[model samples]
Target chain A: MSIDTDDPTVAAAPDPEPDNSLGGIFRAYLAKLRGGEVGSLPAVLGLIALVVVFSSLRPEQFTNSFNFANLIGQSAGVTVLAMGLVFVLLLGEIDLSAGFAGGTCAGVLGVFLTRQEWPLIPALLAALLTGALIGLLIGLLVARLGIPSFVVTLAAFLGLQGVLLTMIGEGGTIPIRNDFINGLNNANLPVWLGWALGLLCIVGYAASTYITDARRRAKNLTVQPLLLWALKTGLLTVVVVAVVGYLSVERSRNPALTSLKGVPVSLVVIVGLLILLTFTLTRTAWGRHVYAVGGNAEAARRAGINVFRVRLSCFILCSTMAAVAGIMIASRTNSVNPNTGGETTLLYAVGAAVIGGTSLFGGKGRVIDAVIGGTVVAVIDNGMGLLDQPQGTVWMVTGLVLLVAASVDALSRRRASATGHV
Target chain B: MSPLLELHGVEKSFGAVQVLRGVDLSVQAGRVTALVGDNGAGKSTLVKGMAGIHLFDAGDYLFEGEPVKVTNPKDAAALGIEVVYQDLALCDNLDVVHNMFLGREMKRLRLVDEDTMEQRARETLDGLSVRTLKSVRTPVASLSGGQRQTVAIARAVLWNSKLVILDEPTAALGVAQTEQVLRLVRRLADRGLGVLLISHNLNDVFEVADDIAVLYLGGMVGQIDAASTTRERVVQAITTGVVPEGGAA
Candidate 1:
């Protein structure tokens, strides 16, 4: 009954508790995988496999720095959209209208910026406001009116597409001539600045980890071994170094004319968002309420959480992120058309989330999961194009990849339940 | 000494059906009061009324000899009354510490204070002499039925509650687990907290209860002393809504 006093005899005796050393942590991780808490393992392994396969098939083209940078720009929109979807899916809800919702917001941006001749910031704000308003309406219907989210968002999907078409006129496109907006996807940081930022990321990650471990240790709580922490930091360091190194090299077709070097601005934006969203989801009380509601709405309500407010907020954040994604896509293409966020865009975003190991069934996901899954989606599309494959082939392969990811999610969920870890 | 909680002539009805009719109950501190009855005996309705989930149509609800109004769950909570329902409301995805401090998490700088929460949770569990849990960080999904019940009970008393009400806490547990939970329930009373335990199991009622309050047809049969009453007499009261002549009341 007394937890404070340590018995000298017991202290002298062999410790019988489970090990908390580095090796023990590794074993525990393996056991978790076996128990079907596979998490991001499958996605990481698949990404590696795809990179190896594509590099072997198109040795010169796929391994080049130019294509590496292209991949980041291509994945930016889907990654941003998937990040939003992660929040919605965490509540066992879907936002089918997110894609067209993005398009509609982009159309608003086009009308404000190109037609009305407004400045960048105001037009951007107007676009984001449009996104928030759409989310508010959808959230109202889903949370307050008690309509099924699937039905509400599905209706919104069709309605938003029509709204976009009407704003831009049927088959019309608005060319974006704004340099700052275009620079989002096409520009790069200076090589020196890129290195500085990359190093800063590594330092920041290490500092945060050290501070958390120190606090936990100060409280006499169970803390992972220092070796495990070092290993994780080392891994992140390697990744950032590799990406920054690759991007720092001159990848321009004509190095004498223009230097296409340093990390893409879109990549920096995405990483910033990833850090912010990850912090929000892991550290904040509102984030915990989200997971609680996702896990068991009844339990959350009984615990005095406003389940409806959590539901409404998630939808609002999802659509706002979608609006950001729409802006990025428009930046990449230098224009806003009815098709800006139409066709395979929403599917790719959802697929990215699922493929990154975010569960379709609520209560399991992270912001980083969407980023990893988005990269996997981008690689498939990029690789298929390099292979000179038909558009049909690319879509089929992407579809099959999504299907397999979903099957893995379902099977792992079943395994988790069987092992009493559900 | 006055009872920690006393309900006098409590009446409740839903539409045309009157679920409870002039029921009386008293729970004393440092004692276990077992409320027993058969199906549709209005045990749940009575407890819900006291919990403010359903306000009694008419009654004198007194706490520490003071008349109080409990119109909602928040009011009941403010009065230091906590209810652990039969279903044991807990989020499986959250760990024991998180579940214990679910909606009422301690925050520092607008972020959940994880270190403080973990420390408090460990201290609370230790104070209850809970040694079955190896770590407070284990997810509720991975815990056994008995452990989950323990967590629920621990959560009920976390807020320095004056009275704790549990509905069928052992109904879904095994014999060994049932014994574990009953011992914990008794330990709660030993800590000078009033405990109102609603159960159908006679063995449980007789094992830890100091007072036995029988409900029949939405009416109180009698609140009898457990040590002086026979099981047959209590059973008779439940079945016929009348106390036997020789029964201690």
Candidate 2:
């Protein structure tokens, strides 16, 4: 009988078995890309292309171990901010105040540390708490009072800038001298410890992949071919080994005076957050509810989900992450000022997310997308600096890139709908 | 046998307009009772009352011969009452399995239990004899209209629901899809559940409904066996707000 038959009896028969071979999986992935589910393919390709072009043009500066580490440090703050924005974007909501919110949180931290003389941990908590309160107010205005998120966050954006300025006394800046706080961006893991962490990441990934597939097999659900899994694991192994190996080489300007080798702690922080957020989005029920609400709020409500709570939590998560990003920025600058988390910070974070393939329309994104896209942004900024390009040129290029990414998002969304995959 | 659900003197009004005026209706287990009416005949208002979207102004809402209060949607759900709205309400971005268990996800160790949910969704679709769908994992956005209706029906029955109220299941479907949905409705009743189908199509009512309940203006005119009455008589009752001469009331 034809599989297309509408006969209930024939239809009730077991579905045609899916092809689980590596070739079959590859073909399916290609089909998905054509259907406008590109995920992070474009961002990854763009990152590689930029790296190649920069290395060819200014190989001495762009490809050095010191610059590589610097790129990671530079991207960490924006990557963390983008990671939080992904949560808001997944709900089809925009948090325009996220940059200034970060600034305000950093100002809070600066005050608690320098003025109150509180220890590091308590000051960090106060900063995070400030972020949460700002988020809660915005969430209430948008989710509960039914104000458009764009307007609410835009208002917060202007208001939070004032809050930050007042906290930092307009023209004043607070210098951070604490060793541990400063070390977040300046310190590096020992070479042995960096190697151990890299291996641990690979092993954890492999174990999770194997265990999930095994469980699916036990339940008689379709699982990807073993070869495909091995290919992915092997690819990750190569990348990890290459990165750790490159960073292990000493890049100290004067070897007799100092030793600078090993992965930056900022990189570690980003990776840890990536793993945690990715797990929350993929493995937990709350994450599933977030996707559902983003996809269709009315349907989610009809299904008995608390639409308001889901929205509120997302705003909270976004701001909390922004606070963490604020900390990273302050650490990198060695001080907190009114401008710490302002001036293209929010723009780059948003660009990073969209360029990485997260739909601004909601219900489609991943935490890893932010990291890949953040790398792209950092590369563009770093490469231009190496070439001695004007600041105006840099802003125009970044704006043009963001415009292109958003256009791609809109066009892909149309294609997805036309192809019945939306 | 006592009816699965029985409403006595149910009256509902909105502001200055009366929508349901002391209406009485009953639905039997192992049978399909089609509620037929014109646009302003209080059909939706009555169904809303039953689903607890709107509380009746005054009424004795009885289920299984016992008076029960259905003040909200949750209350109706507690009584195993499920409504498949005309819009379907399935999230386009989610696959059929996810849509089926949207808010009520099965969880293990604080994580969504995908394995158990997939298995149960597969079994539920199979039990309903649904064949048009190739895979339950397919996103709802990609499914045909008939396939979406099938998923919605399956979701309604998945909860051990005793009463399934369908609001215009075939309203937006083509001929073949309408046939598929009518057959599914027949199967639900055949499985010994009370199926309350609300529709404007006479052909659909004649095809699958075992009993016909006609509403006119704001009152239920008559509830009669489909086999004993003609379509013309039902139409007369719907328009005139009165059972026809020599028609069983």
Query: Which one is best on lDDT?
Result: 1
For residues B8-78, could you state the per-residue lDDT of candidate 1 as single tens digits?
A: 99999999999899999999999999999889999999999999999999989999999999999999999
Candidate 2 CAPRI level: medium
Instruction: Give per-residue lDDT, candidate 2, residue B8.
Output: 90
List runs of model 2 lying over 4 Å from the truth. A5-14
Docking class of 1: medium
Interface RMSD of 2: 4.5
Per-residue lDDT over A1-422 for candidate 2, one digit per residue giving the tens place of the 0 to 100 score: 33565433211213566556777778778877766777888888888988999999999999999999999999989999999999999999999999999989988999999888999999989999999999999999999999999999999999999999988896999998878878898899999999999999999999999999888878777566677889899999999999999998999999789999998999899999999999999888889888999899999999999999999999999999999999899999889999988999998999999998888999888999899989999999999899899998888887877787788788877867777712
- Rate residue B151 of model 1 by lDDT: 92
For model 1 the local lDDT of residue B228 reads 94
Model 1 pairs whose backbones collide: none
Candidate 2 lDDT over B131-175, as tens digits, reads 677767777766678888999999999999999999999999988
